[model samples]
Target: MSVHRSALCRGPYGGEGAAAGGTGCSDPAIFEVARHGRPPLPVCPVHLGPALLMASGVLWPPEIRLIGRVTGLRP
Candidate 1:
């Protein structure tokens, strides 16, 4: 069964939530995603960046679906 737990934000501009009730963002302590064999990892939407933003490539057409297959993550 899947578990629910708070996760710390891993964004580049994260880690300002533990200030003992200070006036700062709470780092969006959200749930985690873990596979049965893999360990739990924090997923911050802020740092994920655009879903498709190829910087420099030389291909007729980028296979975007391949990413989901390789990483087992849904688009």
Candidate 2:
């Protein structure tokens, strides 16, 4: 069995692990983790979370936060 980040890393803009030490899909912390290693994350700098960073009292480059959600279909 294998676990891909695409699965583990997909969710709303605040998903946990999204940032290095974040607590949601869109956590800036997850970006830090994705910055390295195989299957590099294709995160757009422009879509980075500025509001989140500000609320968290963290700083980052100028950009917009592109938010989305990953959901499973049920039959």
**Per-model TM against the reference:** 0.24, 0.18
TM-score computed on alpha carbons, candidate 1: 0.24
lDDT of 2 by residue, 1-75 (tens): 122333333212323353532224442222321221222232323324443343332223422323333234375
Q: What is candidate 2's CA lDDT for residue 6?
A: 36
**What ranges in model 1 sit over 4 Å off?**
1-4, 13-25, 29-41, 50-75
Q: TM-score of predicted model 2?
A: 0.18
Q: Give all candidates' CA lDDT scores.
A: 0.29, 0.30
lDDT of 1: 0.29
Cα RMSD (angstroms) for every candidate in the order listed? 12.0, 9.5
